[model samples]
Target: MNFKSIITSFSFTIVFAIYTINSQNTIGETEVFTTTNQAVGNITFTDTGDLVYSHHPFFSPENRVMIMDAKTKTSKPFPNKAWNTPRTTDDNYLSNVLGIRNDENGIVWMLDMAQRDHVTPKIVGWNTKTNQLERIYYLPKSVVPKHAQPNDMVVDTKNGYFIIADEGIGNGGDGTNAAFIIVDMKTGKTRRLLEGTRTTLPENTPTVINGKHLAVNGTDLLVGNDGITADANFEYIYYGPLNGTKIYRIKTLDLVNEDFTVTELDGKIETYSEKPNNGGMSIDIAGNIYLTALETNSVAVVLAKDKSVKTMVKDANMVWPDGVSYNHVDGYMYVSAAQVNKGAVFNDGKDLSTKPFYIFRFKPITKGVSFR
Candidate 1:
């Protein structure tokens, strides 16, 4: 990420990477909250409105789970314990609770990944105000040292700490670690970064998914770092790398510095480009940085100012999108489409979006966030 400090600061990461590649979200500003996104199933919001969310078939070794009800968008089936095998395609079967964090006492901090040899892979907590289930983080086998794989997470509830991303080759092509894990959601404590850190390898470029090469044996096709978004005065941490075109950060006291020596904090890295997509990120309330860029079928934005990158929205139904949320009390923005290269190991098996994997809602032409 510090490729010669971005090739000698490349003019301050190229004018903030051209504001993160022309960051746009033009909806004529001011639309204070709106949802009920068709097919939305994994969301959260409630003062007393009861908008909880869950639905994931994405890491689908099949057996998708569910639980929705964002103001009667209606949904149910949400099994726990890695969704206990509804029919087993193996891989814990439960996928995509894809990192959600909310606080100020409403309590919502979850990040799920289950499929550790089809079981035992956890880092959980969900108490949307005592609706149940809290704490079950296990992964000290060197944080899944049996071929690592942990995705999308971020929770630093003011020093409780968390940061996970280990997009280590999945969708068959089967394992060979690539990491970034650091947890301590109050002593569940863990650590492992850039596992084999090949410059945090990823950027083989030439992804397609529903149309072709979703990369497998030509660079793991891609490797590591899925998503981590936490900013809005939370003081930095916006990550991306699932074939990343550059989007990074390092400073939560040097990525939770445990007293240096992960090679001097992976040599203190930093590069924040914008041209990344493959589901993983969410941070709004004017800290804009939402993601999903499945090869430009589009849905991207990364602007915490001085770090601007944009593509705000590019319809083609924003396909392949995979999980995002920033409701901010009704200024809606949620996305999901666990196509994941229409699986069958990156589509040589058929799934190129004839449609049925969707969950989108928009109206974001940002001025950050306008909550009234």
Candidate 2:
């Protein structure tokens, strides 16, 4: 109830000013789409263009997920309050979440890390069109290790699979246990793939934001395999470590095939492109990969053809641009400025983030996969 809403009328002027000040080779006019009192972790849009996002769990928000009215811009607990509320008779609440995606079938899949309560991590898929709970896919401890933090995911409804990026930062880990969890929609079976591999592990480099190395409790923040996404046809899944410089990917067929040995799957992995330390990723119909460049406070893209990386937009206000999602209805890609480096955990217990947190949008080079 304390979340105040501000309706800014001069979005064009603000975006124009930001574009003019930044020296990067920007591609589009970045507009301040909306603001929220809490830090938004990730974003997705319904078929009707309704915005639904997760509250960054690092801040310990009361509500895990929220939906903002497309017209009124009023925010409310998504899928009702009980799903967001925890620690009662109800056992089916979202403990902690970050990754959220709206699929083509009108389903919003939320990746619940369960870090808030130290419970079993799971995926909650809600039918937005029907306003009902569709399914809950639990990742047991056997599959989700103690340090596995399932951050983002790609829902391939056409192929009946959900590939998740498990950033191994949980339970005092320093990215040594990161991996991907592949879920079979039909049988709800899960597999932890590529754990501790070179592909899933962070490089021996620190993530410097604004010229300062990002660390927590005097230890460098080493998050592995953070940003992830699949191609339009679900033929390939692209991903890389948060502190790594190379983007690697493999065929979706190779990732889910049990017959392929770990070494064989690793051999099939290709270094797709180079990227800065990033948080979220979304791909376009033309195979362009939009990445949230954390260090530069800008959005970057990996061109599908040349495999070249280019800066899309840069804004000073876009500190720690965490989650990027493309909304096909609006023809713009939305991003969340998480400002994680300013969180108390990273700054000697001093919360320095300024609010209200913002979600910005810019026109994409081409049409994107609507449900990514």
For every model shown, what is its TM-score relative to the native structure? 0.29, 0.93
lDDT of 2 by residue, 91-204 (tens): 599999999999888999999999888767899999998999999999999778888889999998978999998889888889999998999999999999999899999997
Supply candidate 1's per-residue lDDT for 349. Answer: 55
Model 1 spans > 4 angstroms off: 1-52, 55-72, 78-119, 122-140, 144-163, 166-179, 182-191, 194-237, 240-261, 271-332, 335-362, 366-372
Q: What's the lDDT of the predicted structure labeled candidate 2? A: 0.87
Clashing pairs in 2: 225-241
Whole-structure CA lDDT of model 1: 0.57
Instruction: Point out the worst 10-residue segment of candidate 1 by lDDT.
Output: 27-36
lDDT tens string, model 1, 254-334? 888788887788778677656564555666665667677777666677666656666666555545666666566656666
The CA lDDT at 345 in model 1 is: 50
The whole-model lDDT of each prediction reads: 0.57, 0.87
Give model 2's TM-score versus the native structure.
0.93
